[model samples]
Target: MNHLKFLLAIWKANLQSVMEYRVSFLTQVVGMMLNNFIYFAIWIVFFDRFKDVRGWGINDMYVTFGVLASAFGLVSLLFGNAFTLGDIINNGRLDYYLSLPRPVLLHAVSSRMISSGMGDFTYGFLSYAVSGPFTWDGLLRFVLAILLAAVVFAAFLILVNSLAFWMGIVSSFANLMLNAMITFGIYPITLFDNYAKLILFTVIPAALMGAVPAEYIRSASWQILAQLLLGAAILLGLAVTVFRSGLKRYESGSAIQVEV
Candidate 1:
């Protein structure tokens, strides 16, 4: 309970800080919305020419994109530091976190915010609103799915970035893996074979982060929701366990720092 309060205070501070820069915040938010719309346009064009592939249709594409964007945006909005966690760990910035009495991972990851994420988060519901499957039940399912997918994404980021505890400055490798998930996530999983699908579900977790959540929103299947819940729980537990274990081996950067 106290931890929750602490997190709320941190988030409130972050929100206030961003809100202070109103024009810049709005510009970033609007720019991100436009970017997502333009990227989603590729699917609009593809479906225009090829129509549905297998069982997937344009509406399905919209749902998938919405869930993906929402999950990504939420992570970026609240846990923006996840993207830079590897660099932070590599550069000895964990020292700042270590000296604090809070939970290190949570504090470190929640300390930053990306204003553009608001746009993506807002546009997600706009996509869903137009997808024609909005129901009281589906809306509830969509919200649940968004939370689960965001958990998986946050876990995946931790899983990869925690490697920086051992390997110094792995930003390039981390970026490649992140790009793979984002690139593959926006597409219909039906386009992939069993092997690739396996990779998506396990190694990169793109399917869990995007496809499963979208499917849950579309069908409201209890089994799909259960799978997402179980996947998220397992991955989060694993990620936290790994990070805690790695912290024992964490050493400060050998590079010297001089104060200005």
Candidate 2:
């Protein structure tokens, strides 16, 4: 309960900060929405010419985008600092977090907010509401899927960024891995071969971020749900372990006199 209150207060402050620059915030939101729309447009055109790909159709694509966008957006909005973990670690910004009373990893990952993520969240829910099944079961599935996907995405980013602790200045590698996950997650998973599928489920785990949850929503099965939940738990545990292990190697630069 205390941690939840702290998180809420931080989020409220972030919201206020973004609102201070209303024009920039609104522009970022609109720009991201337009950018996502353009990507969806390409698929629309493709589907117009070719009806389906490997049994996946436009509706499946809708769910895919919905899950991916919402998951990514939630992480960006609530835990935006995780996306820049490598830079923070490499630049010695972890000192600021270490000074705080809260959990260092949580504090570091939730320190910043991404304003553009609002657009992605809005677009994702709207897309799902329009194309997804309108039943209670559908809504429950959608919510669960989005939550699971967000967990996987956050864990993956943390895992990748934690590498900076061992290998200094790994921001580029972290960014590349994050971008690859986002790019591949938005597309249909069926396009991949067996070996690629295995990799997605294991090393990269892109499928868990979006594809698996989307599949569960399309056809609700206990097996897929179990897989998604178990994968999320394992990845999250691994990320936490990695971050904590790396913290032992953290060397503070003490460049700035930061209170928090």
lDDT of 1 by residue, 1-260 (tens): 98899989988999999999999999999999999999889989999999998989999998989998988999999998898899988888888888779999999999999999899888888888888945898888888888999999999998899999888788999999999989888889999999999999899999998889999888778899899999999999999998898899998855554311
Q: What are the clashing pairs of model 1?
A: none
**Cα RMSDs of all predictions?**
2.0, 1.4
Residue-level lDDT tens digits of model 2 in 76-179? 99999999999899889888888879989988898788999998887888778777558889879988999999999999999999999999988789878988
- Mind sharing the TM-score for model 2? 0.96
Best by lDDT: 1
Q: Candidate 1: TM-score?
A: 0.96
What lDDT would each prediction earn against the true structure?
0.89, 0.89
